[model samples]
Target chain A: MKSLDFFVYLFIMAGVTYLIRVLPFVIFKGKITNTFVKSFLFYVPYAVLGAMTFPAILFSTGNYAASAAGLAVACVLAFREKSLLTVAIFACAAALIVNLIAMAIQ
Target chain B: MKYFKKGLHDGIPIALGYVSVSFTFGLQAAGYGMYWWQAVLISLTNLTSAGQFAGLDIMVRGAGFWIEMACAQLTINLRYSLMSLSLSQKADKSLRGVHRWITGFGITDEIFAVAMGSNKDVSRHYMYGLILLPIIGWTLGTLLGAVAGQVLPEVIRNSLGIAIYGMFLAIIIPPSKKNHAVLKVVIIAALMSCVFKWLPLLSNVSSGFVIIICTVAAAAVGAVFFPVKEDSQ
Candidate 1:
């Protein structure tokens, strides 16, 4: 893509992103009292975040074994209530070590 | 000020994670022959993960895909709309139109996790504080990686990719552990997501649609079957 075209696309992307995020804030100025809507919205965070994480994450570390090791370590650490940064760093390190050892064996 | 300071403290992990995640983005953009400044500019303007990456993919496919790119971006980012809608209820009512509007701009997954997870209502000052570090780190990391492309070893780069997903898992696990409803919702959503990935017929569905379906479906199931029961413990 040309530089100008790229910029235009960026502008559009930003606009669309802004639109999705701002519309709710602008429109819903009060609490939502309907029990169904309330419960549905309450579950949104965990569902969305959980869906975003797994399966995709398992493939992120390039090698399946390494990704699994990293994922397992991260889960164990997170379940222990490790801080976010700690869990991420330790997981990444675990993946790295696993990847390196796998390569060394080859 | 108190909320703002706490927002900053809460944002630290996210900032660190963004720096790593966007670093890969920088690498990819640079690999595509993008100018370093252009990569930084994109990062500055678009504070989204999947959208920016999907947009980059469409850009690389080279021609006759602008419309496809836009649609792809819209779909990938559609999750943010859901997140913002959820956040709307948590925002402080004292916030003005401008504050609310600005708050919407930085509603990435990590930020949303921190904001929604907060015990108190999210305020404008706190939102700004929460957004500041991640934006700076995201832009700076992109610039550093794009300009200094190829400096990092492949091993390190690939390994750091785990940090982003690890961050995501970290965000959800605590809440799910605390609440069985949250646990069920997460498990159901994950199962649905896995079905989308492994089932050939369902695997044909685009990732964006898969996420949309799983999120809404799991949440709706939770709402119907297991509404929150309030009691003083």
Candidate 2:
């Protein structure tokens, strides 16, 4: 992209991004009355993250063994309520180890 | 000054997470035919993982324009609106307009979660900390990844690409362990995603669309079936 075009694109993109974040607060100030709506909103982040993370650990690369190993490690760590850093490291380590072992066998 | 200090303290882990995630983005961009600087520039301007991923998809396809960029970014970042709204309630009652503006810029998922989850009213200083710390981490990660792309071994970089998914699992699994509702939502989402990916008619949909559909469907189901007990809200 041209320098001017790129900058202009960045400006517009930033503006729109800021608006998306800022508008809800400005418009909905003090108006979140419905209990179900509030509850749903409260849970949306966890729900959204869960949805993104699920198949990621189970079906990555269409390889069942590697993905299952990763999921198993993650579940074990999570069940222990390990720190986020520890859990992340262990899960990735599990996947990498599985892949490397598979390669060695081949 | 206080805000700056607070940002540093709360931002450390976030910064760490950003570095790890953005490094993968850097490596991917390099692999996908972007110049090193281009990858860094995207990280600097966007500073969002999902938005950057979508932007890359559009850029690689050569089908996106400024308008599409705007729409794609807005759609991916819609969750921030809710985060910020919840944050506004958590913020100090006496906060001025300027503080709101400055703090709003830092309202990321991790930062917002940390701030909202805090027991005390979130101070402007801490909010400032939330913003600056992650930016530093994210920016540095992008720069390092861009530079490392040419130097790092392929095996190492490939392994790092899987780290983001690992982080995602880290975030999901713990919450699900304690909360049965969360566990159900995750299971339902996985089943739906598998169906969409496996079914002949829907197998061709993009990953982004799969995420969107699964999230909305799972959340709607959760809302209906496990309506938050009346007193929690």
Task: Output the number of the DockQ-best candidate.
Answer: 1
TM-score of chain B of 1: 0.92
DockQ of 2: 0.48
Q: Show the lowest summed lDDT stretch of 10 residues, model 1 chain B.
A: B224-233
Candidate 1 per-residue lDDT over residues A27-48, each given as its tens digit: 8888787778888888888888
- Top candidate on TM-score is 1
Q: What's the true lDDT of residue B18 in model 2?
A: 84
Tens digits of per-residue lDDT for model 2 on A1-70?
A: 4556556656766676677666654444354566667666656666656656666546552346666776
The 10 consecutive residues of candidate 1 chain A with the worst lDDT sum are A1-10
Candidate 2: stretches off by over 4 Å = A58-67, B1-11, B30-35, B57-64, B86-96, B109-123, B203-206, B230-233
Full-model lDDT, candidate 1: 0.84
The DockQ scores of all candidates, in the order shown, are: 0.69, 0.48
Across residues B1-233, which tens digit of lDDT does each residue of candidate 2 receive? 77558657756656776887788788778788777788887777667788887777667755438788878877777777766776665567544476676567667667776665455777777777667868877877888877775565554444444445555566666667777887788788778877877789887866656766776677777778887775453
TM-score of 2: 0.82
Residue A61 in model 1: lDDT: 79
Highest-lDDT candidate: 1
What lDDT does the true structure give each of the candidates? 0.84, 0.68
TM-score of chain A of 2: 0.79
